[model samples]
Target: MTEISKISLRNLQKRFGEKVVLNGVDLDIAPGDSMVVIGSSGTGKSVMLKCILGLLRPDGGTIQLDGNDIGTLRQRERNALLRHVGMLFQGGALFDSLPVWENVSFGLLGAGGISRRDAKDHAIETLAKVELDAPTADLYPAELSGGMQKRVGLARAIAASPDIIFFDEPTTGLDPITADVINNLILERVQELGATTLTITHDMASVGKIASRVAMLHDGKIIWSGNASDIDRSDNPYLNQFIHGEAIGPMRPDVSTTMPKETY
Candidate 1:
C-alpha cells in the first residue's frame, strides 16, 4: 500500500527585498515520516519552515496540508490549522517567568481549554515521557540546565499530542551525550504518537539517528532528498561539500578567506 503525503509544497517562492529565498522549492512528506532538512547557516531552511507554519507569507506557490491549500487561508483559518502543529524551537523558547508545568501546559491552556488541574496532569505525563520528573515542574526556566530546559520544551511541544511537529535545530547547543538523549526522546515520543515531523539541523549525527529521509537545502532550493541511508553515497557536489565540511569543492569559496595585501 502506498502512503499518502501529509504535507506538500510545490514551486514555493519567497523573497525579502532583493534577497531571494525559497526559489521554487518543492517537497513532500508522508504521514509519520521524520524528515530532516540539512543546510549551512543562512540558507532558506528556517524560512521554508516559517512559510509552512504561516509565520511568514510566501510570494508564490502552494503549501498543502492533507490536500488543503494552507497558503490561501485567512488568519483565523491558518491559526486553526496551526493548532495541529507542535514546535520545538532552536533555543527552546520557554517563558522565563513561567514554571515548568505552566510552560508544558501552555498550549493546552491557551488552545485546548483544559482546566488548570487537568493541564497539570497532562504536563506531568508529557514531562515523564521526556524523562523529566514531577518535582521539577515548579521550577522556573532559569533554574534548569540546558538539557532539562530542552526536555521541558519537548514536553510543551507534545503536550497536546499534535499531529505534526516541527523541530528547529533541536540538538544544536547541547553536548554530544545530551544531544543524543534528546534525539532518542524525540524518536521515541514521535513513534509513540505516530506523528509527522520536520526537523532542521546541521548535526549529521542527529541526521543519522532521527531522520527516515533527508533533504539538503542550498541556493534557496532543495538540492537533494532521499532515504537517510543513501546520503553517504550521494554524488551531488553540494551534498559532498556539505557532508565533508570541505572548503575546497564545487561550492563557492568563502569570502572571509580574502585579505587585503599589506605594503612593506
Candidate 2:
C-alpha cells in the first residue's frame, strides 16, 4: 500500500515585504519518510519550514497535514496541530536559565502537564536515546559543549514522541565525527519512532547519511528532488554545483543578488 503523506505543500508562497521567498513551491512527504531540503543561504529554506509550522503566515498557497489545511487554522487549532510536531532549531536554542533535564522535558511539562518526577524520568530516557549519559541532565546549557547541547535539543524534541519532526541545520558547526554521530542518532530515532521528518541543511555528508530523498531549493522553489542514491548522478547542473560546493554553476551568479548586503 502507498503511504499517506504526513505533510504536503501546494503552490506555497511567502513574502517578506516585496521579496518573494517561496513561489509556487510544491512537495509531498509520505509518512515516515526522511526528506532533506538542501539549498544555499537565503533561498527561503527556513521560511518554508516556518510556513509549515505556522510560525510565518504565507501570502498564498496551502499547507496540509493529514489532509487538513492548516495554513488557515486559528491559533488554538494551529497549536493543536503543532502538538504532534517536534522541532530541533538551528542553534540548539536551549534556555540558559533551565537545567538540562528541565530543558529536555519543557514540552512535556507544559503541554502534557507531566509531573516533574515523571518528566525527569522521560527526559533521562530521551537523553539516553541520543546517546547522552544521565549525568549531563543536571548540568546547565552553559556547561555543556556544542555537541552535547545539540543532543539535549534532540532529546527535548523527541520527548513528546511527536508524529513529525523538523530538524533545521542539524549538522551545522560540528566537527566531522560529532556531526556523523548526530546524523546517525537522527536516523536511529526516526527509525525507532517511524516518524516522518523534514530536515533543512546544506551539509552534503548529513544529506547522504540521513536522507531517504533529497530536494534542492532555489529561487524560492524546489528546483529538483529525487532519491538519495540518485543525487550523485542527478546530472542537474544546479544539483551538481551544490553537492560539489563549486563556485561556478547556474546557481552561483544568482547568489550574489539573492541576499542583501548586510546579510553577507
Candidate 3:
C-alpha cells in the first residue's frame, strides 16, 4: 500500500513446520537505495529474502512492490512483475557446463528472439562492466578462479539491466583484497544502473563499501537499522556484538538458530 518503497515487507512471517524462520519481519527499501541486511546465519536472512522473491511463501503478512501486494497478483501477473528483478547467488551458481558468456546472458537468452551471437556479444559487454576481459567469456566456470567466477555472476545479474537486484553474500570466499574489488564493482554497477538493491551479507567490509543503509536481522526480526555510517556508533548491544565479532552479547550461540560463524 506504500509506493514510497521499491520493496516493502510488513509483519512477514514464515515457518517450516515446527520451526519459525521469520517472525513478524518488517522492512522497507526505497527506490535506487542499496540496502544491505546483515545477521549471523539462521537468523532468517535468507528466508526473508526468499519470501520477498516469492521463492518461498510466507504464512502471514504482506510483500509489496511499488505499493501493490504481490500475494494479490495472479501467477502470470506475478511472473511478469518478477521479470524486472535480478539475483546473484552466494556461490555464483553458474552452470558448470555452460560457457561464461552463456551464463552471463542466461536470462537475456531465455526471453527469446536474441541470436546466440548477439547474446554472446551482450554477455561480453556486461563482463567488461565487471572488469572481466572478453577472453574470459570462452571459459567455463571451473576454469576461472573464485574471484573471476564472482565477477561473471555479477555480470549475469546486471546483464538484464533490471531495476531491482538481490545479492546473496556477494563477497563470500576470497582474499580480502579480492573481496574489496568485488565490493567496489558492485557499488559501481548499482550506481551506474541506479537500481534498488537488497544485499544479504555478514561481511562488514562489503557492507561498508556497498550499503547506503544497513539493517540487522536477529531472532527472525529486524533488531537494528540505520545509515551505514552509523553502524559503528550505534549503542545497540546486538549490533556491537556483531560488527565487532564478539563472542558474547545479547545474541547467544544456539546450534538451531545460527548460520556458520562469521568473522567479518
Candidate 4:
C-alpha cells in the first residue's frame, strides 16, 4: 500500500467544460507541514483548495485525508473528517449579521462542539489568541477594519483547534505593514497549534514568512516546489519570471483564467 500523507491529491483533475483548471495535479501535504502554493491570479489555486475541502467535486482523482480517500468517505464520515479542518477565506467571509463572538464560534456553535452558554466565552478566548480583545467580539464584521476582520476570521478558524488549516490569500486587501502583521499572527498561531497548513497566496512576502515549502502552480500544475528560500535561485524560466514579476517570459498571461475563478 502507498504510504498515506496527511492530505494527498493524486492525478487530480478539474475542468469547467473544456477549460482545464487543474490537470492531473499531484501534491501531498504531510502532518504539520506548512505548505504554500503560489501562483498568479488564477491557474486553479482556489479550485484546487475547493476540491480538497469537498466544496467541489473533481472530474477525476482522489483527495485523501489522513490515509483515507475523501472521495470514498460516506457523508457522515466526510462530515467527521471535515470537523478537523479550518479555513480562512481570502475575503474574511464572515456573516455581517453575526457579531464577532458569534462569528468566531460559528463552527463550534453550529457543529455541536460547544454549548450555547459557553460559545461566547470560547469565542472571546479564541479572539484573544489572535490579539483581538474581548470588546471587539461585540462588533459586527462590518464594523471592523480590514485587519480586524482578518483577525476575527483567524480567530474563527482556530476556534475549533483543527488539525489542518487552510489560509486563502491570508494577507489580501491589507497595507504592507498590516499584511506583515497578519502573516506574523498566522505564523504564530500555526506554530502554537502544531497543525498542518495549506496556504494559497500570490503574495511573496507572505510566502517568505509562512512557507516551510513553496510550490509554484502554472498551467494547472505545480511547476516547482522546494524550500521557500530556494525560490529566488530556481533556474526554471517560468519560476524566474513569476518570482521576479517580469512581463517578458515564457509564461503568457493566462487570459483564459479569470481573477476570482473560471466561470461555470
How badly does each model clash, as a count of residue pairs?
0, 0, 1, 0
lDDT of 4 by residue, 1-264 (tens): 237478888899998876788998889887878999998887889999999998889989898888889899999999888878899999999999989999988888878856876999999899999998899988999999999999998988899999899999999899999999999999999999999999999898999999998898888888898888888888999888988889899988866455444444
**Candidates' C-alpha lDDT:** 0.88, 0.89, 0.90, 0.89
- Candidates in order, TM-scores: namely 0.92, 0.94, 0.94, 0.95
Residues 105-187, candidate 1: write the lDDT tens digits. Answer: 98778886678999888888889999989999889999999999899998888888889999999999999999999999999
Task: Enumerate residue pairs that collide in model 1.
Answer: none
- In model 1, state the lDDT of residue 127: 90
Judged by whole-model lDDT over C-alpha atoms, candidate 3 comes out at 0.90
lDDT of 3 by residue, 100-161 (tens): 99999998888888999999999999999999999999999999999999999999999999
Please write out the lDDT profile of model 2 over residues 105-182, one tens digit for every residue. Answer: 997788876799998888898999998889889999999999998999999888888989999999899999999999
Q: Per-residue error at 17 for model 4, in Å?
A: 1.0
Error of 2 at 227 (Å): 0.9
Candidate 1, TM-score vs. the true structure?
0.92
- Leading candidate by lDDT: 3
Superposed on all Cα atoms, the candidates' RMSDs to the truth, in angstroms, are: 5.8, 2.7, 3.7, 1.9
Error (Å) of candidate 3 at residue 221 is 0.5
Which residue runs of candidate 1 sit more than 4 Å off their true CA positions? Answer: 1-3, 253-264
- Top candidate when judged by TM-score against the true structure: 4
